[model samples]
Target: MATLRVGRSVARWRVWSTSASVVVTEPDTLAVAREVVDAELSAVDRACSRFRADAELALAERAGRPVTVSPLLAELVGAALAAAERSGGDVDPTLGNDLARLGYDRDIAEVRPDGPAVPPVRRVTSWQDVSLAGRTLTVPPGVRLDLGATAKALTADRCAELVNERLGTGVLVELGGDIATAGPGPAGGWLIHVRDRPADPPATVRVTAGTAMATSSTASRSWRRGGRLLHHVLDPRTGMPSSRVWRSVSVCADRCVIANTHSTAALVRGAGAVTPLARAGVAARLVDNQGQVHVLGGWPS
Candidate 1:
């Protein structure tokens, strides 16, 4: 876990595979925020984690047929399928096997940095292959579903809402740059630093109330296998990491899931993303592989 003092009363935790920054108007409410945040994250991972054997996601995948799921997994899968629909298969949820074959079968920390690149599976699966109705989840044999793209953002949105509603205080949560805020923010709203990668220099934005922001990158969490470089963001069409066009993309929308959907799709769309994002009525900042940054749809001044 990591902490930093922002202004005076902000307390943050860099856990759950990313950073969670929480700030309260009253410093005394800090402990309450932590407890709520931890519970929310734990619930999400336990329900959806691809690596956890007990997770409903794993159980559903291994069933090789339709199976009943918990309410939590159903909602999470619903969100993922919604994302896939919104992005037109650009951000499919059925690429879990592709991710595994690409050497991301476990948590990033546990993945061997020196391992050889995993070749893509010959089987081609689409998000349409998986069906969800009411509380039942069905996946044909050999289909692997992973929600790494939108799950964390959804978690951040829920955490912020829970903390704000429970404590009646302002809450700002940044789960690895999937940011969300609820209730009332501080005097100048919430200050956000948008970066191409975690360590890069930032472009700051101030958000108020219900806005959520997310960044998707082809940079970090990457490893080389057999002389080829690979990172997380996979193109559903290719079943492989997207072609190196943009280094990163960031977007802001009404909710964290929406923000993540746009950001991930923008990265996959590469240079062609600007037009579509503008049409979607969302603000975006994209940095290409050549280090040139492009801004569209009025992404903060």
Candidate 2:
């Protein structure tokens, strides 16, 4: 399953405090594909970024009333809410304040690796508290929405679709490790290297066109506060970083948002995720805290 890079052109950049990459089968279309990806990323950031004061999410939060949002923001919010529902609240979007209280108030790049002890935080607000009707969004006063669980994956899906639609070329878009592919892939398929950290065991898997993959990890985007290591994935029920049952969870699905939704939810569900993931017919790879790997639902071994 080694990547066949011979005929592909790639462009990479940073966005939302993480890396972004775009790959195309046609070399001549790389520049235009990059432009499309950049534009899509910018639009997603403006609509969903929790760290940006000027982002639509921030403005909506400040309004303290029903706000008419752009279609893009509305879609992203709807996606987040839907993910929360599908995961049974395991992947929540109303944890923005919880994350900030845990010292993740800023971008991961800007967060101090060592910081003061996290202060006592209030109970997490449920995603049900947020409402979206048509293009109107309503966030309960004092509730904050964080779209981290689905926005990036949705952007990858959208970017790949847009590039393929507009340029008539096969495209793969990866924001961080969430990947989506459109149009026809290479002869074998698109090869993806799966690993949570550099020290973790890695595997290569091939996905055909129109397939998507996403990885959520407790080993990344982590920081130490008061000598306690905390990661970005939190259990909404407790408003605390999820237990390190699985260091990382990667899932493959027909869409990036679906893959990401399960991956993140798997992290929160810990060891109990195996049955549900398999029952749902999801192909998943889970790596434990001790680096042991488990494959489910016929994930490539």
Candidate 3:
């Protein structure tokens, strides 16, 4: 149990073999945090995890051509498919094999020294390659599904709701940079650090009560391939890492899932994503590759 006392209103708990931090105002909320975080992580691991054979995604993959899927995997795939359609195919979950071909098959820690050299670019199999018939999901031969972007955000949202329901109090859940907060904070809102580049100093943002925040950046969780930096934020159109038009995009919406939906789509949208995001009433702070910043609709000007 990795624990840290961060502030008066927040205590950070590292979980899920990844970081899962919870924020709460009540002193007694830690118990709920413990239960909710574990359950959420377990749910994500079972659903979309590529590394676990018993995982729902793995079973779907091995079941051989168009099989009934577990509810969790079906839900995640359905969400990804919807996002792909809504974002004009900006975000695609069928790029798992493409990502692996690009040397992201293993965790960042185990990546070989020469692994960064990206092979020749490949074609995106397209989200349409995935066929969902009710509770059944089928991927075209050679297609793999990855839900890193949506799954993490969904987990954060799920855990927050779980804590709120179980503890009968508000909760905040942060999975890496993606965060979702609920209930009342000490102030009128919850304070969080926002950054474009992961290494850069953080700028602060206050999320009003019951709202959640998520940040998606091309700069974080990236590796160098063929002397070029390859990031996990892939463009569905090109089947390659985004060109880094935006270093990061942080969004505060009513929920973590929605914030991630906007932020991930925003990263893929490049410069053209701003107006739509703003018109949609998303509060967004975007940092470009050149270090320029733009604040969208929800932020104070």
**lDDT scores of the candidates, listed in order:** 0.82, 0.89, 0.75
TM-score of each: 0.94, 0.96, 0.90
Task: Report clash pairs, candidate 2.
Answer: none
Candidate maximizing TM-score: 2
Stretches of candidate 3 above 4 Å error? 1-9, 15-18, 122-124, 196-201
Q: Name the 10 consecutive residues with the lowest summed lDDT in model 3.
A: 1-10
How far off is residue 18 in model 3, in Å? 4.4
Candidate 3 clashing pairs, residues 3+ apart or interchain: 116-225
Write the residue-wise lDDT of candidate 3 on 80-122 in tens digits: 8887876777778887877787777776566553544665565
Give the total clashing residue pairs for model 2: 0
Q: What lDDT tens digits, residue by residue, belong to model 2 across residues 136-179?
A: 99999988888999999999899999999999999888888999
* Model 2 residue 219 lDDT score: 91
Off by over 4 Å in 1: 1-8, 121-123, 198-201
Local lDDT at 228 for model 2: 95
lDDT of candidate 3 vs native? 0.75
